[model samples]
Target: MKSPRVLLCVRQNTLRWDGEPSSLCCSSCCVLRCFDDRAAAARVNQHAHGRGTRTSLVRHGDPRVRLIAAHRSPLTALFSARGLQQITRQQQSPATQRRMRQQVSSEPQGVAEDILHLSAWLARQPHLPPVDDLLLDRFLYNCKYSLSRCKSVLDMYYTVRTAVPEFFKHRDATEDSIRRSCEVTLAAALPRLTPAGHRVFVHRLLDADSRRFDLLAHSRRVFMLVDVLLHTEPVLGAVVVLDLHASTWAHVLRAPPPLLRRLAVCFQDSCPIAIKEIHFVNAPGFIRKFLDIIRPLLKKKLNERVHVHTGGLETVGKSLPLHMLPKEYGGEEKSLKELSDAWQLALERRRDWFKAEELKRVDESLRPGAAPERAQLFGVEGSFQRLAVD
Candidate 1:
């Protein structure tokens, strides 16, 4: 006795519905069609036996016939007509192509290619730590994509991290003291951007108590914020708004000159982001004395960008958009207290990630390049000029 035959439809790009061959035009197209009826099987066999049509006959006991009715994979459908048309328009538009090319060219030359080349270059040199694509990209960006400049900055960045143990070492955000300092410092990156596309970062001394203000902890918090921005925000530069309104003389006195100098050098030389401007708002009279102490340490260009405004919020408004500032600065935005509370919660959420970063550091002995001479790189020790106390 012969086994019963099953009729199956195998038309290309055609659908099947209700045991009938159907075109894709139908809104309810079935992906697969199979028939076990003897009459339907006999009809399909007669027409498709020698016509080379997609119809196929299978024995009733064949396991393969049972699998024929399964739905077709959605991945087989590449794109819709509308999607293809949109892609065609984008490719045809000269203005769109030109704008895209310009944006790509603005980045370091061969950004993707350089990542591979730099990785290989670092591997050949002894004593260098393994280079990751993300870190290399940051170095390239900070150096304006110049390969040589990128290499130089990379060296300096790790060197500074190793040299300044006070600022970078043992910086676990989970510790009680460090967490308390982060809350008191109230350093945060604002959601708003400057008119020129620079991200706005505001730092204020929320706690006037000198005991709570640890310069090292404050530096760690600032670096943590910078790390967050580097990965998340896409901006050309940064505008730092330093609100010294609540800062007291005790806080200033606790910030030693040497520590301040190290912080300045790290930002000026090692950091991979451009500091567009540093707005010192609500500054005190004695602030100038402190500024005078560090003025010589700063590069001439950076010093020019530093604006000291003592005329209250009105003076700061002249340089920045008042509408973007917090309510304390006469802006319509959220109050400083509200922003600070929200930021504190954000930091708490990332505590574990920050802790992991604290354990990772560069081994100076492994550097194939010349080790950074701390005295020559930072400056002569005890050479800092004393500031006038009166």
Candidate 2:
């Protein structure tokens, strides 16, 4: 049996060489022919660099090199350690450049420019809501930064807002009745974004009193807050964490299927923001039954994203980061009380804007296409069965 032959490369006096027989004179680097003789290897090293090359570490100012066993007849020069380092440096530049380009492309200035262009386009259209930069940007964002989709969503948003007067009409966030309903903390959008850049919204029934639950007022507040978010921030998507702990049968009975249907249509169809996930934590068995009633009405994609976490917060934590959640949910963030108070304060500040929004209705007669029929517009029908309470 023949011993494996080792090819050697040496860098002496700042000149590098590899063990290739074809080229004796080192132009760039040379590879020494594979030899099994230890004495021959030592002799070759002494002649090449006045020292043995067996040690992995070379002195400072010495060329970085390595030796590899070449069993095949043809000696191939394996890249030296320095050569590998150079190749790595070369490879990293493109990735760094790509990352820089991504950073520049994601700047808000570009988004602002797009919104300006959209605002100009909206200025020419009739019977539309006032096309301010903020509103236009929200439309642009909701449509996933597409101009055409933004226009469509803007049209549909107003059309639906016009049609659903019960929810949109008289939307005074400062009113005692509206404030009281919102105070229940059925849901509240967090002040921070998730690691994946999604806007986190937590929903849980704080009050068991069915009479004070006012589903319409809660829906209005939710939409109002959503509108505020759209106008205030450049949100990419939403993550809803629904905690159904402490919810009673009374709360289940108050779940109006028709209102749920309308809300589903509004978010799934009319609204521009993409609901990335709807996670139900501490979900009761009855919640699943309630979901079955509304599941048919929800978009298939959305229904698929709905996760029921009955096991507890650990189950919810698998999808949602613990840092993004409130302290009550075994997280590091502020308590739900603090979050809800901040949100309520934000809603209070936007009271006048909500009133203005409530009055800004789309005139169907002035619309370019055929007016949408009331029945098709609202999605309200007498066919929805009342939710049965056990």
Q: Please report, in order, the local distance difference test score of every candidate based on alpha carbons.
A: 0.58, 0.59
Give the best candidate by lDDT: 2
Summarize candidate 2's per-residue lDDT along 1-390 as a digit string, tens digits: 322222333333222343234433332233322223444444345434544444333332232322222111011112112122111111113343354234323333356467667768767667777765445645665556777777767777777788777777776767777778756755667654554556778777777676677778878878877876665544567888777776766876786777777777678766777888988878887887878787887767998998888865546654466765678777776677776666666677766778777767787777666676665644556442221111
Task: Give the clash count for each candidate.
Answer: 2, 8
lDDT of 1 by residue, 191-221 (tens): 5555554567788877778888887887876
Clashing pairs in 2: 17-30, 18-29, 18-30, 18-31, 19-30, 19-31, 19-32, 20-31
lDDT of 1: 0.58
TM, every model: 0.67, 0.67
Residue clash pairs of candidate 1: 127-366, 127-367
